[model samples]
Target chain A: MTAATADRVVAEARVCVAAVLDPELPMITIEDLGILRDVQVHDGRVQVTITPTYAGCPAMDAIRADIEEAVHRALPDHGVDVLTVLAPAWSTDDLTDAGRTKLAEAGIAPPGVSRLAGAGTSTTSRAAVALELSIRCPQCGSPDTRELSRFGSTACKALWVCRACSEPFDSFKNH
Target chain B: MRSTCEAVATEAEYAVALADDALVASQRLVEWVARAPQIEEDVAIGNIALDLLGQARLLYQYAGSLTDPPRTEDDLAYFRDERAFRNVCLVERENGDFAVTMVRLLVLAAYQRELYDRLARSVDPTLAAIAAKAVKEVAYHRDHARQWVLRLGDGTPESHRRTQTALEAEWPWVSELFDGGWLAPALVERGVAVAPASLEEPVLAFLREVLDEATLAEPDPRPAVTAGREGRHTEALGHLLTELQHLARSHPGASW
Candidate 1:
């Protein structure tokens, strides 16, 4: 493949991998979790960078294997390498707005931007900070939820019990 | 021993020391997978356990790579006799309750956080690099444990009582972590290891903050009885190892 073709193929492979659902949270893709970082194609090999959900998350190995398989299947003749990076810690804040919306829609409440939302900014042009600090319940659309545990299923989410509905649910906590 | 490069023993010992703690604790933590009080906590602890396991793999692999005898991580983790294993006995203890487990985690993670932070700047390049990466994970571990200690200690009368008892029970083991045997001092002399004693104040301060938040009092410090690094593990590790290595031992060369 040519250089330009390889780059396009690499980008396409990333999008394909992004469609792969997380085993724990089937609603969100690994990419939606912001675990996928960079993709590059060199020679006949395609290198992909993914930050782990947590330090020792078992899902990472599975995710890597899945990525490699998916990429290889997508680009038959190219080799794929999945690189795990641990420098900058993974945070729920890295979730894209669309990802958050997907999570909220799936009934797993996404984290609210407490620091950003409470900054008292009125002009909403993607200001780095806004006043949307309360995590609304995906089930009940209420902000009256209490944090039960800092850790949730798979170590990437936190346990939050909603007060309005009296139902316990998981919230993807910020790192 | 040779002068400069002759420091092999210290490097190997340091790696074993950290790896032992990680390996044993990880074994214990993985037990809580489906048995946790809640699914969220189950995954959380499992994740932490997994992190420690990773560290163990790296440290043990690094140690194996360095030593001429060439022992793999599995060899050091499973095949070694008790006397050859250098992990602290405290880490090998059973997970009593959520409170007990959290207390142990709080103390160990806090200590490890400081240890890794200092080791991140070690003269040994490998140790420094591993520590730098590990520091981030350990920080999260410390936070997870800290948050639990607070919640359990201050939650209710029952939770407070349980968490306090757990804290006191685990306090005796804290001393052993700060005083390493011959290996620790050697590494310290070479500027490759942080003295466990220097970590005491910061660790204590962090613990105090958590305890205070939990509405719990700091337990009086007692002189710890040492044995872990010298290979004197609790009876728990033997059982733990038996369970962990069962499949691997039973099905030799069995890959599923």
Candidate 2:
């Protein structure tokens, strides 16, 4: 294939893969979740790289399968490969602004900014960052919320109860 | 090629040791899913277990890649016998009560946070990557256990008593975690692994601060007979393996 064609193929594959939704949080696409790391096309073959939100996310397998299927459907004759990388570790900070909006609309509080952005520089300072940042309640947009549990329905979230609305919701825990 | 091969073997062994720790701990924590004191606790413990399981899966998969014939994560996790496992004895101890679980978690998470922090700089890229991601998760785990320890250790009289007792019970196992066994020293020399012994000071300091904050006294230092690193384990490990591996072993190649 021509260079231009290959570039187009890579771009097309990215769009296809990016459109695949997270299995657990169905409203958000893998791209929006920042899980879809990169898409490259070389020698008429496409390679897609992804990072997991959590180490043992059960949804990773489904996400992989979904990416493969979507890419194959988009480029019928091209070979598609999905790879999961662990380095430069994933952070909730990777989530897109669009993703944050989608999460709030779903009544799940998105994670706050990560404290580990430059973590390797100093371990002690990194650990000193407090985990209990105030999270706005999605239901009533109330800042008056209390953490009921450090864990929620899934590993990625924590349970919080909004004092104003008396509603319990999940806040995507910051990494 | 010979040196490369040897390095791969050493790295595989080191990875197995790390994986086993998370795997056994996950099994113990999974028991609290429905049995915890409250629904919130049930979810909390289950989330912690799942995180451990995730770390275990990554390590197992990395270890499998370095093996001679290569193994899948499932093969390493579900097919291995207790005698072949290489986790520290601390994680293999059976879960006692809620207090016991919290104390055990507090100690283990503190150690893991230090271990992972150091391992993130490993020469082995895959191991370093795993450690970097794992350190973040373990930070949460450590904080969770610390919170509970503070509440239970300083709360009611009954809670204080139970938590203190549990801390003492779990203390003997803590020394074993700092023991740098045969493979560890060699890996540490090569920059492929962190020296377990080096993690002792920081881990203890963190735990001491947590204990002090909770108004709980540090337990007397008494080391247990350490053998899990050598594949010898407490009887509890065998029973745990039986329950964990039963269905998978009974129905080979089974999948939902």
Candidate 3:
């Protein structure tokens, strides 16, 4: 294949792979979740690098498989490789505005702004510095919601209940 | 002549030691999945266990890469015998009660929070990266345990009594956590690993804060079962490992 054709193939592969939805959070694509790191065509091999949002996220294998299937649809003859990395761990700050919108529309609140201040902000600091911070209820748009549990159905969410609407929902746990 | 294992602990050894601690605690916590008092509790406990398991996998993979011939994380986790395991004794203990489990979770997660935070800046890049990721995840675990301790300690007469009893039951193992002697001194000096002893003050202070808020008194500071770091463990570890390694051993690369 010519250089231009290879470039076109890589771009098309990126589009297909990026559209692959996360297994657990089916509302958003991997690219929207910011887990899709890079896609490149090197020496006739297509390489895709992605990172996990949480260390033990059980959805990673499913994601890898999805990406493979997606890429194969675009370039059946090309070798596709998926590599998972750990450095620069994922944060809620990585979520795109579109992802946030999708999460809210789906009744799961997106991560709040404060959750983005990674590492230096400990729970102790959060309790003291950011008291009264509330997660907007996606169901009724109520600012009055209480956390039911620090963890939810998966590794990346917290269970919360709305005081106003009495609707229980999951909020993306800001890590 | 001394065996290579008898000499100074390599970075891989240190990684495996921590990994074993995570893996064992994870295995034990999995027992509470369907048995937790509430459905939320079940997911909460399971999530914590999974986070630890993830940390263990990362550490073991890093450890394997550093070894001469290299071992996969599974090889290190399943192929090793009980005597060869290097985790501390605290994690392998059976789940006595809800309080006992929470107390153990609180103490271990606190130590992990401290260890991973410091290890995030280690001289070794791979270890540093893993630690950086882990420190964030473990902070949530510590918080979960803390919240539970607060509830159990202050909830009701029966809960208060049970929680205090659990704290005491788990206290002896806390001493073993700060004993840094088993780790190679060079690792500490080179910033690859922190002296476990250095974590004592911070961990204790955090525990004390939680206890004070919850109206729970501190347990006796006496030491017990302090040799798991050196590979001498209570009978509990063997039993724990048997269950953990059973599927891997029996299936021998079998996948669904």
Candidate 4:
């Protein structure tokens, strides 16, 4: 394939793969969740790299299947491979602005800036977590929220109750 | 001495030991789902179990890769008999009660968090990468365990009593965690693994602070029943493995 053709194919593959929605967080795409790392094309073969938001996120299997299907459909002639990597780690900071807005719209609070604002280091100990201080309720836009469970329905989220609205919702856990 | 555990000499064996720790702990933790005192707790414990299971799979996969011809994670997890397991005895101990479970989780998480934090910089790239990912996940686990430990230890009179008892019961297994002789000395020298012995001081310091805050006294040190590193285990591991491996063993080539 020509360099330009290869580039076009790669770009197209990324678009289709990026549009694939996460299994659990259906409101956001895998790209929005920062789990989709890179998509590379070589000799009409596509390799898509991903990282799990939570190590044992059951959604990983579903997301892998979805990525394969999406890439196959978008680039019919190419073979697609999905690989999960565990380097550099997935932090809540990887969530995009678009993802944050989508999460809020879907009534799930976006994670606080604990990882981002902690001098850009992810200490993550109990005292260093600072996860609770900034969780504004998605329903009422109130900062008065209380954590119900450190864990939620999905691996990456925590269950929280909004004191202002009394509506329980999931908040992304800042890794 | 190192004579008993000398067989666990290579990186593969080291990885297997690590995987066994996670696999066994996951099995124990998952028992609490639906049995925990509250729905939130069920979710919390189950989530913790899932993380441990994930870590186990990663370690197993890495260990398999180092073999002459790679084995699958399932191959190691299912095929291994009780004598092949390298997990510390603490994990295989029954999840006696809420307090016992919390105490076990607290001690294990404290050790894992510190271990992973240092292991993240390991000379072995694959292990290092896995450790870097795990360090974050384990920090939350440690915090979760700490929160419960403090609550139970300092709560009501009964809670304090049970929590204290649980801590004392679990303390004997604590010494086994710091025995690094199971691994080849070269592994630590090469920066591929940390000496488990070196972890004792930091781990104890953290535990002491938490125990003090919770108004729980450290029990007198009991004689160490250490041999899990040498694949020697209490009767509990056999029963646990039967439950863990039966389905996979029966279904030979099954997958969803």
User: What is candidate 2's CA lDDT for residue B226?
Assistant: 81
lDDT, candidate 2, at A1: 71
Best by TM-score: 4
List candidate 2 segments past 4 Å from native. Answer: A117-130, B1-9
Give the least accurate 10-residue stretch of model 4 chain A, judged by summed lDDT: A116-125
Residue-level lDDT of model 3, residues B130-165, one tens digit each, is: 888888888788778888999999999999999999
TM-scores for every candidate against the unseen true structure:
0.78, 0.94, 0.95, 0.96
Put down candidate 2 lDDT per residue, A20-124, tens digits, no spaces.
Answer: 999999989998998888999876678999999889888999998898899779998888888899878888889999999999999999988876532354433
List candidate 1 stretches off by more than 4 Å. Answer: A1-20, A112-133, B1-9, B30-48, B61-72, B95-99, B120-168, B184-192, B211-221
Clash count of each predicted structure: 6, 1, 0, 0
**Chain B structural similarity (TM-score) per candidate:** 0.93, 0.95, 0.96, 0.97
Residue lDDT tens for model 1, B50-79? 789988877898898888888787777767
Residue ranges of candidate 4 with Cα displaced over 4 Å = A116-130, B1-6
Docking class of 4: medium
Tell me the alpha-carbon RMSD of every candidate. Answer: 6.3, 3.1, 2.3, 2.1
Residue pairs with backbone overlap in model 4: none
Q: How close is candidate 3 to the true structure, as a TM-score?
A: 0.95
The C-alpha lDDT values of all candidates are: 0.76, 0.86, 0.86, 0.87
Model 3 off-target regions past 4 Å?
A1-3, A116-132, B1-5
Q: Interface RMSD, candidate 2?
A: 2.4
Error of 2 at A168 (Å): 1.5
